[model samples]
Target: MKLFKNTFLSATLTGLLLAASWPTYGFPLLIFIAFIPLLMAEQNIRVSGTQKKLRVWANAYWAFLIWNLITTWWLINADLFGMLFANLVNTLLMSLLFLLYHSIAKRVNQILSLIFLITLWICFEKLHLIWDFSWPWLNLGNVFSDYPQWVQWYEFTGTFGGTLWIWIANAFGFYALVQNLSRKTAQFILIISIPLVLSLWMYTTYHSTGKTKEVIVLQPNVDPYKEKYAIPNLEVARGLLQQTDSLITPNTEYILAPETVLAQNLPFGNFEYSEVRSLLRDYIYLHPKAQFLWGIDSYDLVYDSKEVTPSSNFVRDNLWVNNYNAALFINRNPAYQKYLKSKLVVGIENLPYKPILEPLIGNLMIDLGGTISTKTTQKERSVFTGDDGTKVAPVICYESVYGEYVTGYVKNNAQFLAIITNDAWWSDTQGHKQHLSLAQLRAIETRRDIARSANTGISAFINQKGDIISRTQYNEKTALRGLVHLNDVKTFYVRFGDYIAYAALPVMIVLFLFGITRRKKSPSYYWPR
Candidate 1:
């Protein structure tokens, strides 16, 4: 009874430490300590010989479930029903992952067990990134973004490497706590500490070779509820243009405004209509010298009927809804390019699993800006060339989260990254911070300077080494003008993606096989709940 009480308290304490170390407080070292108590709980389950392996897993999972629920409750604001489902599903997934670790630890030696846990944890992280209903937001590596210096090594291996580093630290710390081999455990800790200490050394000393450029980012602080939809289209356009004009100067080679700043009632590409054409012409004339990149909605006409509706077999459905979440690149020389956002946010931007849920949800099309519903057509990566022939990869808002997607441009020789976003909807929550934090990884991944322009919040310049050189205030109606760096040099992560995660898988398989071959010789022990 005393052991049970001690174990439960230890597990819960570990869970709390893990949650507290996330993006909220930015203390990633807390994660290295967080799992020590939980590992002790596992050791108690085995060394004390009180509970069956399965029962121990169930109890550990319950503690982790509680931790997940308490920490991620903010997801409810995104969509109440969606949040509930995500919490239940993700908790179950995490529990199964923990089960694999516990089962493997049953047969392996201490060194092998530690390696197994690290491999298992990273495999699960990779699974979440690729799964159709992926939620890569809460990755343990993301916790390190608060100490930007520690994650500078991301240029080599991406955030997954950071995940490995943290887990290895925790494993050593746990080994020190659970066993009584003072000298042996000290040796183990020293071995593990080598990598951790080296990462810190590398973090402080890393540098990048990249050229910088001067750019201006404007955030009007337009209220999502009031200013976005309250007034007439012409009134909103005038306000945005006036604000943009004030921020522009001779040195500002490029200017950026938030997503959907121009509130045209009609669809974006109804340009045959004089009103729409006039708006584009006026915008073009306003910023004559500087190249301006901003988000807008557009519907392009398709001449080839088959090309129009690629998904439909019948040409009768040829008038396909060519809706897009798009960005327009306008230069002083009357050159313009349009790039549609490829990766859409699951719930808010695109309906989650529309084909499966549409029958139950009753035409789940919630219109925001124009008459046409939010739809997807062709998805493309965009790079815009300025009047001075400076080329940039334009990352539209959510696309910044996808490291591989941004790196694809690096492989093609993109000079800089320009991300335009409307973060007003998320405000000061972890949502905004998480979004800003992840952008750092992309810069490190691609080895390219990032000019991030956000609405109602953090606009900043990120260097090739993933350092934020300059930034703007949250909720301020202001412009951040700075010299943004540019670089075409590619990092190892960009050249070879997910190498660490993939390499871990074979090691995990070996551990699994070793556990299977070394199954306990005695009859299975059982304990009642």
Candidate 2:
């Protein structure tokens, strides 16, 4: 009973430490030692002569579920079932990952065990970025988001470097704690502080490299539940025009509106009746240099059988339609341009393993975007270019959460970044704030200024250094105009995306193979109880 009590308390302590290290309500320093208690508990389970494997997994699950619940409880404001599934499934996966590492510890030496643990975790995070059921909101590196001064090196290693740093610190810190205030305590302090000192020096001396450009971001403040879709697209366009009346200027090179601002589907290859275009074109003629960009629900009708793919919805025996959650770019030269949103939300935008999951689950997918239908996506990230050859990455709502995914745009010569989102679906919660924090990390990684526009809040201008230079409040109707720089120099992260995750993959595979083939009979080192 006493051992059980200690293990339970340790598990919950690890959870609280992790939750307390998150942004908006917590500090990043806690993350350095957050996993120590759990490590101790795992060590205890191995040494306490308890041979039950499920016991090890159960405690890990408890710890992970607690962390998931505390950090993302605000997801309930958006979708209860989605939130529940996210927590339940993610907890199981995380526990299994920890269990695998624990198994490897029994077969291999301590040093190899630690190495495998870090490599396996890094590989898991990398998989989360690409897989269909991706949800990387709690990646450990993100803990330093609110305090960018501590992670200025993200330009070189991206968020994976931060993840690596946290694990190394926790490993040494755990060792130091177990030694009872021994000489290694000083080593732990240096492990925690050395990277921070370097980051601070970079923050203080770094100069932004780019040409200054002005932009205007609009926040319509429309209620997503009742009125977002009920209104006509013409009315939405006119409302946008009215809001930007005073703010629109000749110096404004780009004008950004929130994602899905055009609730109705616009017919592709034809814009004769595009109300947003009509109003914007009339106004844009006055300031021909300004480009109007917005997120739209768009569709392309096809009778030609060759143009259709599996994503196309069958309208009749011979007709099909391709639906897109897309970005619409309007200017005099191109008149109208569209970029399909590629990275889709798991259940909302596209079903994970649709051919497999659909038959098994039978339509459990939910649409919190106010628009229905599983959205079809483009294969590649498309860069929207102006007449003067200014390139911008039109990042839609959920795509902003991905780190390496955003680098694809910069590689394609995107001079600046633009994020259009409708965060009102989650209402007033940490969901939107956490999202904005992720965007800041992207700004730092790419060294490109960001023009972020959102429906019902958080329209802002982020500099090349990840600072929110100017921003609007949540649940407010306003237009934000600010100057942003266009950078041609790409950061090391932008040049080679997530190299840490890449390097970790091969090491993980090799370690796993060795652990299975060369199992040791005796314990490497018994944990002192």
Candidate 3:
């Protein structure tokens, strides 16, 4: 009973440390040792020779539950059910990974067990990026986003490198604490210092010599619950034009508006007939040199003969339609292009396993006054080229959270990135702030400047080095104008993308197999009890 009590306390301490070390509020340095208490708790269970696997799993679940609830409790403002599902399900997944590590530890040596833990966690993060219920917002690598200068090397290894760095630091720190030896402690300090030193050196020496483009980002600040969908498309267009007229100059190359700024569902086939498009065309006529990128909720009709994908919404009379949360690019050219949002928010914009689960509890999900079904997506990443031959990638709201998804835009010759989002649905909470911070990681990984426009949230210009040059206050109707460097050079991460996680897949398999093949042994004390 005493041991169980101690274990629960240790778990709570681990969760508190992790929550207190997260971004937008906490110091990231605490993450270096955040997992030490939990590790110690597991070790104590193993050494006690009593219900080792069950105790470890229980303790891990408790720790992860506390961590998830504290760090992401703000999600409840968006949807109570979503918050509960995310917290409970994500904690279960994390605890399962730790349970796998505990099982492996009982069969292998300490070094192998540590390696297995790191590999499995990285793989889990990678899986989170592509799965239907993706929620990579809590990925360990993102903790350093508040301090971009400490992660300049993200240009090479992507966020997976940060994940690897944090795990290695925790392992060393845990070992040093258990051994209580001066040499081990010094080794832990050295491991933590080397990467930070290299990152600082790289940050100080790096320089941007690319061409500069003047960009204007608009934050309409229309309340999502009150004024956004309630207002007509023309009114929204007039508001955007007023903001643009105040901020845009002759040298301004691009004017960006936030996601779903045109709340009216425009038909994809008759986009030119939309009043918002007409207004934007007139605005572009006045500023002939400027290009406009804006977000729209659109739909396209399809007949019976047309092949339909999973996201297609069936209607009566042998007719079906595809709904898109998309970005529209307008210029002097008569024809405009649209890029549909590929990555979608679970339960809100997307229904996971729609064929199976939609029949179960689909009505519980909120539609936010747009499409009642899953959002349609394009297979290829599209880059919009201006009249002067400069290209910009239109990254819609939730899509910006994906690292490799943005790389595909760079690979298609996007010189800069424009992110348009409507974060008001989550209210003025950590949800919007954390979303804004993650864009800095994208800027670093692709080595491309970012013009981020958010409705009722943060609107800012981020440089190629992941520094915010200018920003607008949340919930304020304003516009941000700044110069963003246009880089043609691709970083290593942009070229290769999440190589660390990809490499870990086979290594994880090998380690798992090796552990299973080894003779099963009782837990031996790797640390003094």
Candidate 4:
């Protein structure tokens, strides 16, 4: 009973420490020692001289569930059932991975145990990034988002590097605490200090490389629930035009608006007859230099059988309609361009395991702002070409959260990053703030300037160093114009993409085999100094 009490206290401490290290309002430094308590508790259970394996999983689940609720409970604002499902399932996945680590540690010696733990965890993070049930919201590396000055070295390592850095620090701190080594402070200090030092140096010394262009980001502040669907698309466009007319200069190169701003659906093949298109065309005719990009609700009509896809929704016997939450970029040069959002929000934008689940629950789907069916996505990252040959990546709301996925734009010669989003779904919570902050990490990783336009969250310009240069207040109906650097350079991370996670996969495989084949080891050998 006493042992269980101690472990429970320790698990709670881990949960609080991690929550305290979160972005926007929390002190990020706490993440270094946050996991030490959980590690100590697990270690104590290993040497408790009893069968307490179940205790490890129970304690881990408690700690992780607490972390999830504290950080992301605002998801309840959108859908009550969705919030609970996300928290429960994500927590289950986290605890299950930790249980695998505990299982390997029971059989292997300390060095091999720790090796397997770190490697397997990295592999899990990689899976969370690209897998079918993709959700990377709480990936450990995101802790440094609010403090971009401390992780400026992300250009080379990306967020996976930060994940590896956090794990190593915790492992060393736990080991030092166990050994009571006052003399081993040097190694532990170096582990925590080196990344910050390098980051600061880079943050101070690095200069942005590229031409500067003027950008105007519009935050029309349309309430998604109340006014967004109520008003006509032409009314919204004219309102946005009034805001843009006040900000545009002779040199304004790009004008960006929020996601899904066009409430009226347009035919996918041709947008000539679209009412909002004519309103925007008149505005663009006046400003010849300004290229406009905004989000819209549109669809494709597939009459031919060969044109049908897995995501195409059936309208009748032979006709199929494919709805898209898409971005449209227009200029006088090539006329217009389009890119569909691919990385979808779990239940809101996409149905998980759609093929398998759609059969069981036919025609039952959740609709937020877009359609109920699964959104169609393109295989490649599409880049919108600027008027004067500057390449701009038109990243949609949820798509901006992906690191490697954004790099696909850089690979295709995107000189700058432009994000359009509607953030009123969660309404005045950490959801918008965290979403804005996560864009900072992408800026650091790609070494490119960013201009983010949110409907009611925030519209801002971020520099190459992940620093917010200019921003609008949340929920404000406003517009911001700033000079953003357009760069054609690619960082190591942009070229190689999550190399730290890549290096750990093979090592994890070897250690997993070793742990599985070896017999259970003595308590003394189960942990290392």
lDDT of 2 by residue, 336-431 (tens): 777888888777777787767766986466766454555778877889888788899999988988889999899999999999998887778888
Residue pairs in clash, model 1: 212-485, 213-484
* Least accurate 10 contiguous residues by lDDT in model 4: 362-371
> Each prediction's Cα RMSD?
4.2, 2.0, 1.9, 1.9
Alpha-carbon shift of residue 86 in model 3 (angstroms): 0.8
**What's the TM-score of each model vs. the native?**
0.85, 0.96, 0.96, 0.97
Q: By TM-score, how accurate is candidate 3?
A: 0.96
10 residues in a row with least lDDT, candidate 1: 520-529
Model 1 CA RMSD to the hidden true structure, in angstroms: 4.2
User: What is the lDDT, from 0 to 100, of the residue 339 in candidate 3?
Assistant: 91
Q: Report the lDDT tens digits of candidate 1 across residue range 139-185.
A: 77777766666666677778887788778778876665445445666
> In model 1, which regions exceed 4 Å deviation?
1-5, 46-54, 66-71, 107-110, 184-208, 229-234, 263-268, 271-287, 300-320, 333-335, 351-380, 513-518, 521-529
Q: How far off is residue 144 in model 1, in Å? A: 1.0
Ranking by lDDT: 3, 4, 2, 1
> Tens digits of per-residue lDDT for model 4 on 79-160?
8888998898988998888788888988986667777788888888899889767888898999999899999988988899
Report how far off residue 181 is in candidate 4 (Å). Answer: 2.9
What stretches of model 2 exceed 4 Å from their correct place? 1-5, 179-181, 520-524
Off by over 4 Å in 3: 1-5, 359-364, 525-529
Q: Rate the local accuracy (lDDT) of all candidates.
A: 0.69, 0.84, 0.87, 0.86
Residues 1-529, candidate 3: write the lDDT tens digits.
2333488898998899899888888898899988888887887787776688888989999999998998899888877888999999999999999988888887887778898999999999999999888999889999988889999999999899999999998887766666665578777888788989998998888886579989999999988776777788899889888998897888998899999898877788877987777887888778887788999888988886467788877676778888899998888889998899999889887888777776787534565676667788889999999888888999998888889899999999999999999988778778889899999999989989999999987999988778888888888999989988788998899999989999999999999999888776665445444
